[model samples]
Target chain A: MTLKKWIKTPKGYVAIAMFAFLIIAAIGYKDSHGIKNAFTAVFAGVIVDIILNIIKRRKWTLPEGAVITGLIIALILSTATSILVVGATAVFAILSKHFLVYKKKPIFNPAAFGLLFSFLFFKTGQSWWGAFGDLSVWTILFLLVGGYMVANRIHKFPQVFSFLGTTFVMLALMGYFNIGDAVDALRPPFINGTLFFAFFMLTDPPTSPAKDKDQVIFGFLTAAAGTLVYAAFGGLIYLFIGLCLGNLYTYLKKRSVSKSMVNRKGFISTHR
Target chain B: MVKMDKKWVILCSTAVAAAYTSGFYSTETQAVKMESAQHNQISLHTKVQQSGTTGNIANYALNQQNKKAKQKYKDGTFTGSGMNRRGDIQVAVTLRKDKIVDVQISNWGMHYSESDVVDLPGQVIQRQSANVGIVSGATYSTEAFTDAVQDAINQAQNS
Candidate 1:
């Protein structure tokens, strides 16, 4: 698709926004390897996506989804991660996108799934450098603005707001209570990383709810589970684990809805 | 079988609360142990310094001369720990003839993979200094590792 046409789509706009983030983040990176790692991830994502599409006999299209996933993985993973590992993560993310689907939609956020995989298998570090976690706190404005634009384009404001609100509220309560390592989440890099995840990953349409009510519930569950995990385990995987749980909920909700619809159709046919 | 009903909600809440309480207690206990260890080390160092100063003039001169002849690091194995937001890293350093002969790191908490930084122990040994320059992407883990190594060096010098 042409640039003008593509810009009108949610994926295109999000991709552009992510690239903008990558630019700002790379400029602030301490060394030259930051951009190279990102490139490796993107390259792997594109190649794997195209190959999968071919195997599935789908029409050739720009791998926009894969690109976004690659960018997210690159941004969240530590810049110190080896190039091979970065590439492998992107490949795993794209593969999960193709395979881990229900009714033609991914059941989990590919980036989050792949990141958790890397963490478990490779012990990869997460610096959230793309979110400008390492940079001065003022740089968060860019993330906020970019995130707002993407969320608006996707009409996921409800999910984004609820997640962020619940997270901060939970964190504040924990801090007030002097809970286990809860105060740390309120600090610079953790806060930045949480916002980045809320705005970008939590707002994934296929894996999150569309209705405002369900969105609110989903957000609450995600934040609660994530914060609880953080409080209990105090590890780097809490956010991703929380997100995966939310995805599971969404998948189940969709399954039940479809089941009810099928039963309703059968009853209508019998009555007719 | 997961349900979004009140019963499920209550059950999950209770479980979460229990986990949080347990975690809080565990963390508190660890913090107290760390603090106590630090306090004891400080007290011991002060006592040693005070004892050295209270000796006779001739003994003090002899001790000074002996100290000047002593190596910067006593050959032995020493262990130290470094902590960061993600976790604590413990390193065991071995010194032979005032050179760092070996380093072994144990990271029970979340940190970078071994491949993330190429041969961190080798770097420490090659440089013969705890101030091995920061690895670009693994700054936190590097800092923690270097801190632990430096802590071990401090112990070696004190010994």
Candidate 2:
């Protein structure tokens, strides 16, 4: 389909609306310390999308994935980071979306993978400004609105709920144990960094499991693993690692199911 | 039919097992890198010194003299060195009394080049200012550089 056709789809509209909200929210929050950093993020997002789309040559359209991911990256990075790093991160996100997949299924959440790559290799920070900001309330509102729209489209509410609830419970227990001030630090992941990631990044359809049962398992595992990593590492990298692990499990499960089905069909045909 | 499906189940389970093993290996590899990165970014080469006194009266007099010098200079520079598996960092920091003035950092170590860490010192210096903000995406490096600079400042003050 042409880029225009793709943009006209329901998913397209959701993407556009989310991008608009990000731009507006970013501009509104510009007065906050290092608000100007959003420009670099937006710029990086756009440039990376453009380049990737050109390479793919599928009717040049704005990459909603890159835009949202870039905004999230920008929001998380400390205000002191240079714009160049933000742009590089955007490029990494898009590239991961394109490159890190097997059997036509993506192996990781593009944005999360990008952020992880930056953290591990590029030494980029993920401050998650949305987690601690003056306009945190507004940020939460934006997430809720965007999240409802995206979740409604995919009918993945169970997955979302399981992930969020499991993560909260795990962290709460960890906090109760007084493991490194876990309880005091335990807050709604939905409020800030976790919300943005869970709502947008984790919900990517291609990379995530499709079956409802599988999704429930996948989401819970993702959250549980992420919390464990956070406890061990005491940073945001654990979040991405958790998601990536979940993706790997889902991918393998899907492949196994399909392979078995293929084998069954072949055996039945040969017998008949 | 049920008997045959058992084989399929076994195959699927085997795939899962293989994938789990691969995932574990990858995670292990990534974890090593993460740990090394964190180590490379922090330093513990710190020193502390205090000025010698001629007498009680002399100590007071020296304190006054140092205070004037500090006021007039309004800035002083500090330098320190540290190493990790990745490489070594020699950090220079300039401070205006309690405020940071400027920072110059040089690194000699590791598979990663100094250019990878050059901006780190500046980030540390900038964020040290009262009006400074956190560097975008460069959090660990900033911390590493800042820690080194703090060590240097402590050394200078003691001297």
Candidate 3:
């Protein structure tokens, strides 16, 4: 289909809205830092998308989801990070969406994968930007507003809440242990970068678990894994590692379900 | 129109390549700065005399000096407290020696947990140079812990 026809679809509208909102928000805040980072992110996404499409013999067009994800990640990361790292991460994200799975199905959240890859190999650091300058009051208000909006739209309130609640309780236990003031130090993870990842990145429809029960399981497991890694390593990269594991688990479970369905259909056909 | 003129594809790719190159070069320079900072270390020592009548004052001075030195250096420190490590409060203070250094508690009870606020010592040394920051989150523990360390320093000075 032509770009015009593609833009008329529901997914297209969502993508467009996300893209426009991100750009406008970047502008509205008059955040020169965010705006500059956003530009590099979008540019990187567009470039990567075009290259991938070309390789696959498809017509090149910007994927709105990729752009929005890049913008959000940029907003959440520290300005101390160079634009080059941001752009490299965006490219990795788009490429992972296209190439990191069998057939056409994505086996990982592209943003999560890219962030983890950047953390490990690129040594890119993240700062909590969505918390509105790391101001506690602003962080809380933003979480309430942003969390509610995301929960309502995605119908994943239970998953998000359970993940946050469970993680908070676990960290509180660490605080009880006096493990480097885990509870107070842990505020940044919940309110800062990972909040955006939880509400937006991990909850991507195409990449996340489909069933409600499975999603709850996915959420808790992701949080638990993240908490464990953070406790062990004391770094920011483990959050992405946890989410990636959740994505892998979801993929495996989906494959098993498909296999079972096929077996059932074959049994009925043979019996009949 | 003739497959929408594929010429723009080449131009776009070139532009992206240029942007990537510029970004990479600039970041490589910053990465060097970060590496240098990581390896940088600072060390300083200050002496305080204790009045024979009140050794607490000298201990307080030494603790304050250590914190101030760490802050001045903007580097981490390594400090230890308590006699023979079997005390209600044994702490380690790591300092670069011009500012308040990172503080670690080697031993403390559950009651002491609240008082072991890290930022308090760091901030106190930063602001007052010789005073401790208010352990807003954990008051009693901070006082007991800071005073105990101060006492150790006073003994060192008296000796």
Highest-TM-score candidate: 1
Deviation in angstroms for A39 in model 2? 6.0
Docking class of 2: incorrect
Tell me how far the alpha carbon of residue A48 in candidate 3 is from the true structure, in angstroms, after superposition: 1.0
Which of candidates 2 and 3 is the stronger one according to lDDT? 2
Quote the true-contact fraction of every model.
0.13, 0.12, 0.00
TM-score of chain B of each: 0.59, 0.42, 0.35
Best by DockQ: 1
Q: Comparing candidate 2 with candidate 3, which one achieves the higher DockQ?
A: 2
| RMSD vs true structure, all candidates | 8.5, 12.2, 16.7
For residues B1-159, what per-residue lDDT tens digits would candidate 1 score against the true structure? 122445643464455445445444544545566557546654644664464532122343355577876554578999877656544568888987666788888654433455644577788887776767777557787877766776676677644
- The digit string of per-residue lDDT tens for model 2 on A1-272 reads 78798666645655665555556555655734444555666677777668766777758654566666666676666666677777777678777877777874568877788778877767765555544333545456776676656765665655676677676666555644544324212333323667667776677787887667777798899998988887765544667898999988987887898899999999999999
lDDT tens digits by residue: candidate 3, B1-159: 011123543453354335334433434444344335323311101233222323223354476686763221223444433221111345555434333444556656322223235555555345423246544323334554655444333333313
Highest lDDT scorer: 1
The regions of model 3 sitting more than 4 angstroms off are A1-31, A58-62, A179-181, A185-190, B1-159
Candidate 2 wrong stretches, greater than 4 Å: A1-10, A31-62, A130-139, A181-185, A188-191, B1-63, B66-159
- TM-score, B chain, candidate 3? 0.35
Error of 3 at B152 (Å): 18
